[model samples]
Target chain A: MSVTAPLGFRAAGVAAGIKSGGARDLALVVNDGPARAAAGVFTANRVKAAPVLWSQQVLAGGRLRAVVLNSGGANACTGPEGFQDTHATAEKAAGLLDDSAGEIAVCSTGLIGERLPMDVLLSGVETAAGQLSRDGGLAAADAIRTTDTVSKISFKRGSGYMVGGMAKGAGMLAPALATMLCVITTDAELSSEQLDAVLRAATSRTFDRLDTDGCMSTNDTVLLLASGAAGVVPDLAEFEQRVTEVCADLARQLLVDAEGASKAIAIEVVGAASEDDAVKVGRSVARSNLLKCAIHGEDPNWGRVLAAVGTTDAVFEPDRLNVAINGIWICRGGAVGDDRSKVDMRPRDVTITVDLSAGPHTATVHTTDLTADYVHENSAYSS
Target chain B: MSVTAPLGFRAAGVAAGIKSGGARDLALVVNDGPARAAAGVFTANRVKAAPVLWSQQVLAGGRLRAVVLNSGGANACTGPEGFQDTHATAEKAAGLLDDSAGEIAVCSTGLIGERLPMDVLLSGVETAAGQLSRDGGLAAADAIRTTDTVSKISFKRGSGYMVGGMAKGAGMLAPALATMLCVITTDAELSSEQLDAVLRAATSRTFDRLDTDGCMSTNDTVLLLASGAAGVVPDLAEFEQRVTEVCADLARQLLVDAEGASKAIAIEVVGAASEDDAVKVGRSVARSNLLKCAIHGEDPNWGRVLAAVGTTDAVFEPDRLNVAINGIWICRGGAVGDDRSKVDMRPRDVTITVDLSAGPHTATVHTTDLTADYVHENSAYSS
Candidate 1:
């Protein structure tokens, strides 16, 4: 089921003339009742978008009644006018929902540094509000997209309620907590603190491990809002699990939709001296364009992988290191292992296992193959 | 003047069949007499090439007579056999030069992990030694290239002597001291410690500021060998300046030949709180694929530039930050400064200036536009 498939929540999506292609440019997801608690994670980039700054402050006190999202203009680096535009949009959304402006969150994605066309945006907001329905989740999901080829939404049925989310991103994606604009809605009763904890834990493993291009965005944000319509709060343990599952599902979708991506690569580092070391090594490999490109070319260039891992400070003897690509041992004891000719890397799913032989700790990072389309798409755009 | 133009040095380049295309694959550069001091820098990557490890140990005492290099195989992560191959190659070179094995430095680049066709490599060494000449510098430069489209060589006449060098790299390049293999021959006398200082200072601003694809290689190395054959070593200050100039020229050439690069972009961060901050900001911009691609498309997308700078920790009020692309102020105070139509970004050479307005420190980094050709080349290669 989709995010708005729950009770006491209504969502709508509308074309706002913001996108040049005339796709849905405005989307609204609202909670129609009793619970009004929210938590959010924003981009670590010190230069935040105007909408990100506005929503961050609004979510500070844990109250959120609606999220007003628009696709087309990022509303970033637009200075004072951008900030004012964000405020005005929030005010309009809150007015339509019969709530205070302070209770609405704002999100924008698309080209950066452009001002929002307020005339179209305002009219689109009115249309969205008029069309709001509990079953409109799928439409809303399809609305908040920029470069993403497909809409990403995930749902998890918990002990008493359900957690659902929609995310949009294809590039400028990396992670500290989350790497894209994601809005999650739930019918379970949850306080701000519990939501914060569960969101952080869930993101730590899910979104935080996906590095498509290693570019972190100024508009990256993840918002979790609880409707409390079910009137049944889940135990903290179960709530965390459900949240984590939903996040994982969403993260997987983001990876699958990474720009110019043909394969979703999983680099697993095992036998590291510590979990941190494994993560460090995995990240190094995940960010290596050479290795990624080689993988895209279907070349079992295990040496590039070794080179990436070696660049990290993680302690391990090169001789003790072992590498396997696509379930075939390519290198062992710092030397060539089995016949590399036997390894096939043309599959859409690729895995690289690096055994450090240092400790029991392990970590896995998801990445995408480098492709010509990535360069073409990114280079052709002005933003 | 080229590297071998210096007195007391003999060099040669020969085809060893290491390259499948039947190109030159072996080079031998030797110091004939009167000097034995050398200094070296190797890739910071932990998964080092076999030659890098061997040279790191041999250059520790600061004395060397020759450097034996080969293309077509990096000899990295090949385990014990790789190390053995490197040793044998070095020993053979030393034997031909009438020098100790420990006195000869070794470097190899090409495909990584594959064993060197020892039979071909050893025979090529003999051919190279027999063909050694003082005018073989250019041939040596050409012999060491893998995917590089052009030969990189530079020379400078110091107060009383001369310094010349060559380098080869087209991808898997970034600045962490050095990103590719280079060798310099100097007629001036200098100790190992002195050479180290001079090399470090030169590289700090030259090779250290180059970011091509943001990928660090496993076989990067830079070696400087002084012959002291002229017996007219000048003051260290004058010598260092000349060395820096030569390195800068070579570094620029490397950028020009960067894979799939259609334009060379220079990003300068001025008025930063500290030099480190300025460097950090410059690097952040240099490593951005979106910005690089935008520049490639001849689109002045200043928003990507601001977004990149925002990801860094440099202290700057986002609104106060001003960006000038190709000498036109596209953004000021985090907003559009002037008409974007006035800014032209169609030049092959472009400069982006970011005024942090926080301090007096500044830094500049060299990068290239990301193009479809680069993606096509890298994605098709296995190594």
Candidate 2:
């Protein structure tokens, strides 16, 4: 179960014939709630998708009753016509549900600069709204995949409440939500302001830390809707914890299921002057093609680590840095240390630890290795 | 006649046992000059190589008589002993020419975190000094090869003066010199300050714009040696133009000879508010892994271009952006324009032009496609 895992919520997925193969490509999630509170975070890209623009405006009202998402057209760079299409889709869903169009959010993901086939999409929306059920979470999850190899769904059970989210993204990932589509459903009795704070804090620590390919998207979005069916008004800390856990789980899933990834690498930077510096340094190392290539080759090449670190303005002395790959200290005090040949790299999970020896702060970024398969997948066609 | 194409310069390339199989790994270039005014730019990497450190100090005096380069080992991250080795190498070269060690600049390229063989290097310097000749430029160029398939040498004859240079770099390329070693010889009558200004200006427009990859090197160095043998005091603008043309030619060669690259991409960002924004936007697009993959697959993915631009803070309305692959405007006003099929990619050279439509500024960056061979080479061995 995804969104429907929470009380007072219903979900459904249906085929819209938007994808070339007639795959399931449209989804709907509804909050049949006594209390409607919603918050969202959209891509910071100056060029946002039409649906992202619509959803942002809807979420601004601090209340949402439904979310409609399509997988075969991003509706981005389609100009004002695209915006009208998004508005029409939301209004149609609202009319079918006997609700306000201002309370319906929308998201679209697929090829950019293409207008959605509104005829099929509107008809699919009517069908999906009819198919909405409490157990439709998995189906809804399947409807949002683009280049994703698998559907990403995660849920966390809090005391008398729960948080559930489903995410879809393959590549073009980085900080600031990592080019993903996500919808969160919660049955916790909380105000929209509380939900907004919790979502921002949770996302910053979770989805924003995975710098997959350093490419930000124009349609990245995450929506959280609360139904208050469980009647659990938990404290802010507990609520934030549950939300963060679910988001982190989905973030990990995104990394593990990254398109064409051969190995999942965790780059942890320690002993930084501040958390931001640590993240900056970690991101710098994680984004280096040379370092990622070395990781894919399973070569304990620590020199590239130093080279990447040197590019950052973070506080660190060149001679005071240390790097360890898979628990073997291959570089210490900025020079070669342990025997690289002894370091085993046959596993798919790789850990690179960099100690700046500057301060006590630390941060970690999750990433994947650059491989020939990745090149093949991204280069095989335009996606 | 590359580095020695200019008057009052002698160069040599000699076999050094530092590299396996006795390949020529050491080189020497001497300024048999009336004036030894020289200027250089080293890598901005905080983790400086031993040779880079030595050369920086030598250039601090605003004069240089000779430069000794080794290709098989980069004495970086080797600690105090590495610095001592660089000192010894420069001291030996100075002794061979009866000049002060402060007048000898040094450069090294190859595996980092390894010490150079002092005995072999010292002997190789002696042999290279004895082999120095005015016609040894080609041999000198050949000695600097690491992963490069060809020797890059360019010369420009000016009014009563001439400038010649050689360059070598395979990858770990980005702004701030883009990780390369270059020795420029000029017979123009100019002071060290003039050389500094001209070199910075020329490199800013040439080598700095060749961001092959986002990895900056710890051993990048570009040295300009003026022998002033032609006794020609040309105008400043004329001298700068010649130097820029030579550097630009050599930069293009570097891109053409980039390791494992099947295509060279020239990214031009126009209508930016400032030159900095133009370069920044161009670099962001050039470094996108997804975009690079699309290019390697012969996909003219202008959507990826907009996504990359959205990541930067460059001033532009999303709806006003346009992109062209080759001469085909596939995207106009951030919407689909011409058929993407109209663009052709069956060539070694590709150009991606982005019009931000914010102001009247522009910049161009040279890069290469991300290939499977690139991943294989960077990952297969610990370089």
Q: Considering every candidate listed, which one attains the maximal DockQ?
A: 2
Per-residue lDDT, model 1, residue A364, is 95
What lDDT score is found at residue B130 in candidate 2?
96
RMSD of 2: 1.9
Residue pairs in collision within model 2:
none
Q: lDDT scores for all predictions?
A: 0.84, 0.89
Tell me the docking grade of candidate 2.
medium
Name the 10 consecutive residues with the lowest summed lDDT in model 1 chain A. A170-179
First chain TM-score, candidate 2 = 0.97
Report the lDDT tens digits of candidate 2 across residue range A1-383: 88889999999999988888988999999999988999999888787888888999999999999999999878888989999999999999999999999999999988788899999999999999999999999999999988777889999999999899999887444221235999999999988999899999999988888887877888889999999999989878998999999999988988988876788989999999999999999999988888888889887788888988999999999989999999998888998888888788999999999999999999999989998888887787553
Regions more than 4 Å wrong, model 2? A171-179, B171-179
Give per-residue CA lDDT, model 1, range B47-111, as digits (tens).
78789889999999899888888988888777778889999998999888887999889899877
In lDDT terms, which candidate is top? 2
